[model samples]
Target: MKVLVTGANGLLATNIIAVLLQRDYSVIGLLRNEKSFALEPHENLILHKGDITKVDSYDALLPEIDCIIHAAALTGQDIIDYSVYQEVNATATENLYKSALEHNVKNFIYISTANCFGFGSLDDLGNEEKPIRFPFSNSLYAKSKLEGQEKLLRLAKDNPDTKLVTLNPTFMIGSYDTKPSSGRLVLSAYNKRVLFYPPGGKSFINVIDAAEAVVNSIELGVHCESYILCGENLSYKEFYQKVTKQLNQKSSYVKIPKFLLYGIGYIGNLLRFFKVKTDISLTNVQTLCINNFYSNKKAQEKLKLQQRSIDNGISDAIKWFKLN
Candidate 1:
């Protein structure tokens, strides 16, 4: 089948594209630029240059594609421009699903986040039936993704020919992530920059496993249903120790108080008046390091997913980080 993958240049998207190619599916990538990290170069892959949020951008490309995997979104926990995410995360999805209905695409896989579900304990494995909306629903990125999911579900309900499935992953760490995002924090531990550790820990999964779940959902998932793609959880101390072991070295360590981090966020918000460019925006870091663990049983059963141990993910990630 011919599949059109949005955000073809992202870390996760690159991995997803690799899996699809390995499975011998005809893959078409929608990319805004050739230089994007999500971009894949292959003979079976057809790369189209276009903006997903623009009607004129992907309009022609949608007709011949059999499935659509939406993975493009703002990368950070912080809100860059709320409007930009609204268009890319929420609106672009609206356009894609509408076009899927018009063109009769068989399946649509949407990549959502477990962040939509507030931070939970290891025991709190949320399923598709559980409601993620709670007091923490006020956050910008989560709210936008939830809005997009709702919009897609509405489309799925009304349209029989179009199939929609969304995958919610927790704390993805893997290769091809050139950007120094949350996963890279683990890498930073080895580099000696992460001398201190955060208080809260989270569920971890290999990016390859995350990509596999997305492909499996496209191949066999029930229409209009969403599943949480998650794995093992740990405290920051445990996570750090795993990293330190693989590095085979010792580094200074401290437990960063959450309140202080929040204070920094508070100060950053106040400093927003001065206009800051750093990613450590009061809003971003605080929201990210917030402790949370989610369940993956739903994805394990539905996607027949297999997850690598967190140790392996860390070792592999650190090796890649150092080699690069």
Candidate 2:
């Protein structure tokens, strides 16, 4: 079967493409930029230059595919405008689904964010059935993603022939991150740049394991269902400790107060108002304040999903980062 993967140049998409090739499936990678070192040369792998936001660019590629893995999205970066988030994450997804419907695609797999279900603590874990706390999301990226999820689920309910499955993965770790998008935390720690750690915790999984969950969903996944693919939950301090121990670094990270972080965020907003480039945005600080814990029980039972230790994930990520 031929599977078309959008955002083929991204971290998760690169990993997913590798797994698809291993499963003996013909793969077409829909990437906006030119293929980088992230992609390996393979006989079965075909790279198509297309933009997910522009539906007209990829309309021809839809008919030649048996399945569509819509992994493309705007994530892990500070957004200056809300419209960009809506265009890339929400509106683009709706357009792709419309084309998939018109082309009679068999299976449609969407990779969504676990944060859609909102913040979760140790006591209250986010799950598939839980409703999203939309008001809590300060970032346009999260809001747009939630919008995309709702629209896609509605499409799944309306269309019976085309099977639509959404996989909401938690914070991802592991390799092949040329942009170093999801693996930014690990990269920062390894480089001794992570001095202050946030107090909030999050559920995390290895990227390879996350990829397997997506591949398994191709066959074992039930139609019109949303699966949360998560792994062990750990706080920012705890995660930093693991990285320090694994890398054998003597430096320790200090727990920065949330209030101070918010202050920095407010400063970032001021800089933005003046048209200055800033890394630390208010949305970034807001996200770091939330304890985004989630449960993977449903996926474990149904998709046979299994997550390895966080140590293994971190170690692998460090190795890949050092090499590339």
Candidate 3:
């Protein structure tokens, strides 16, 4: 089968492409740039440079694609442009769904985030069936992703021929992060850049396992269904200790007060009002404070998913970061 993967240059997309190639499937990557990451030459792999939001950009490649792994999105802590988020995450997905219907794509796996389900506790973990809690009122990143996911799910229900499956992956860490987005946390911990720790915890997952579930969904996934791809939940302190151990460093961080962090967000909003360029924004503060502990019971039972300790992910990420 020929598969077209959007955001082929991203961390998760790189891993997903590796798995698909190992399975002997012909892969066409729809990426904004071809030189973002260094990939080995393969007869089955073709990199098609194009923008996903612009239908004319990838319209030609859609005809031969049997399946699509939609992994492209505008994600960041410093992102304040709401229009860019809507265009890339929401409207682009709407256009892609329409094109998928026209091209008769067999399977479409949309990658969503676990944050859409809202913050939850260990006693009651977040699940796919749960309605997104005030998605529009949430951070710009989560709100945009949920909008795209909602449109795809609705389209899936209306069109029975096109198989659609959604997978919400939690905080993922692994190798091949050329841009070093999520892996920066592991680097920060290993290098002792993280002086202060957050009070909340979050679910973690190895990118390899996340990619495996994405591939498994092509065969085992049911139509119009959503699954949470999650792993062990750990506090920021525990997460730092694990990374410190792997790096052979001492772990000691001052526990930052929650109110101080809230104040930081409040001040960040104030800075935005003056159109300032700062990393510590309201969205970033919310991410650090929100406890995103999710359950992957649905993915584990249905996709036969297996999750290793988060340490493995941190170790691999550090090794890759050091080498590259």
Per-residue lDDT of 223 in model 2? 87
Candidate 2 local lDDT, 1-324, one digit each (tens): 999999998888888999999999999999977647386689999898888888887899889888999999987455577788899899999999989999999999999988787556789888988777633376677788989988988888989788999999988888888887867887677657447888688798988889999999999888888899999888888888888888898665788898999999899989878877656678778778778788999999998888888888899888998888
Q: Can you give the lDDT of residue 237 in candidate 3?
A: 82
lDDT of 3 at 125: 85
What total of clashing residue pairs does each candidate reach?
6, 0, 0
Name the candidate, 2 or 3, with the larger TM-score value. Answer: 3
Question: Native-vs-model 2 lDDT?
Answer: 0.85
| Full candidate order by lDDT, most accurate first | 3, 2, 1
At residue 1, candidate 2 shows an lDDT of 94
Minimal lDDT window, size 10, model 1: 276-285
How many clashes show up in model 3?
0
Model 1 bad stretches (over 4 Å): 36-40, 77-81, 133-136, 273-290
Q: Write the per-residue lDDT of candidate 1 for residues 170-205, one digit (tens) a residue.
A: 777777676756566676675684478777777778
TM-scores for every predicted model:
0.91, 0.94, 0.96
Per-residue CA lDDT of candidate 3, range 46-118, in tens? 9998988889988888889999999998887566677778899999988998899999999999998887775
Evaluation by lDDT, superior candidate among 1 and 2? 2
- State in Å the error of residue 250, model 1: 1.3
TM-score of 2: 0.94
Q: Which candidate ranks first by TM-score, i.e. highest?
A: 3
| RMSD (Å) of each candidate, 1 decimal | 2.3, 1.8, 1.6
